[model samples]
Target: MSTVMVRPLLHLIPTVLIIAALGLSGCSTSKPLPRQTAPPAAVQTDPPAKSHPRTPAPKITGKPKTTISAAKQSVLVSERNRASCYRLQPGKTSTRMIKKHIPAKKAATAAHLAKKDATATTAKPMTTVTRMVTTTSRCQPQSLIYARCRTGIDTCKLGDTSPVQWFACAKNNSATTFEPVAGSVLVLDRNARRGMPTGHPVYVEEVLPSTDNIWQLRISHTNYDRKCHLDQDATVLFNSTEMTASFMTGPWAPWAKDLKALGFIVR
Candidate 1:
């Protein structure tokens, strides 16, 4: 009984030993499962990148750049030319130097001349000129007797036949005085030099202010310049002491003289 049991056990042992040997051989020859030492620490390296072909750089084209020295030389030359125009003092620019060089008197004179020219160019006041007609005669033959027509007094009223005789006739008919009065007749006796062959009668228009021994009279008369021509508002000078009348201004001014004044006939 013991022997039979031993023989079966021995057969099972051989089978077990064979299986163990196969396991050991597999474990040894399997390359240790490629050293699963934590999967070789998971070798976390990235994949290599792919390379591309390189391209050539583009070339630049233009005018050449100016040198710094040449640029600086141009700026210096321009500054020198500008500086030559003015004699600049220390701490003064060209503008200040030019202002300082201008003379004050010349500036003032220029200003004065400009003002004078402006004044000269300005408009002036217009003057009106009156022209008198000297060639025409409008006086009537009877109106040539100036004192009689102006005063509306006839010779009959003055106790005379004509104006020439009125001065002497007025002594009896009207008042006769040496003093001049407006609306009175001033009589002058015959005087050849004054061109009075008979006598002259002037109507006194105004007795102006007297100066010392002279009295100014504004008189109106006819036939003084030309026959039957009336002269109005003529200036006459009278001497109170000499009792003479002279024309101050008129056509008769050239032949002016102190003519004998008979008197003024007042009516």
Candidate 2:
């Protein structure tokens, strides 16, 4: 209704219409922009560690071999006092040395020979047997230094030159026994002799206790050494009753490997 109001309104309407058309055209033709880039962050890091290979254990070694010396071996040998090791027997002297000189036997005089013959012819007759009244005698036949029978002193008769004969004579005189005593006579058969025809008799000087019901003895005998010896080592085996001897030995004798005592004549 007024001219002034009417003019402003017309002008405002055209201006707004023109602005809105330009805005719509710009929006249809618009393009998107590129994306932005960013810098990287810091990271923690460690130096490389040293490396080593595994090792094996050391091997064990064995002990070295040893050898004995000649002088050391010689020191192990027994001395001369222990002669059994050297001779392999008892009551024997060493025979390793050779003699520089040997003494000669003296010749018999002509008169001495004739006188010996006359003494032999005039000698008293020997008794063949001796009566055995007592069971034991205190005599040692070897101490007499003669081969003849020693009558009642020894367990032998006049004609009993060999040990076998003497043993038989003793039995005939009622001296037969199965066991031994301090003064018993141990009789061995010919089989007990080493390559000898006659048997032997040894006098028991002592009896001693040994292990496991066995007994040890010290004996005296003649001709074992071709002479009389007071004592030697011997082992005896007794029966269950202990009244009879089953076996006997003189382990030190040279013929010990083959010889054994058969029985004993006890007093």
Indicate which candidate wins on lDDT: 1
Lowest lDDT block of 10, candidate 2: 57-66
Candidate 2 per-residue C-alpha lDDT over 1-267 given as tens digits, one digit per residue, 9 for 90 to 100 = 699879989879989999999999887666322212212212222212222221221211211212234323332331112223112112433334333433334554566567744664453333333232323222334522221211123546465366667656667887767655555567666752353467666655566765565556655444554333333445545442343343255533443542455566642
State residue 59's C-alpha deviation in candidate 2, in Å.
93
lDDT to native, each model: 0.63, 0.47
What tens digits encode model 1's per-residue C-alpha lDDT throughout 1-267?
Answer: 999889989879989999999999998988866686656456543322222222212212221244655544543443344223222122222221111222233233455556745665554334444443323333333322445655555544543354556666677676678888766778887787766766788777778878887889887666664345556678999887898889988766677679888878876
Model 2 steric clash pairs? none
Model 1: what TM-score? 0.44
Error of 1 at 33 (Å): 99
**Which candidate has the highest TM-score of all?**
1
Task: Supply the TM-score for candidate 2.
Answer: 0.34
lDDT for model 2 comes to 0.47
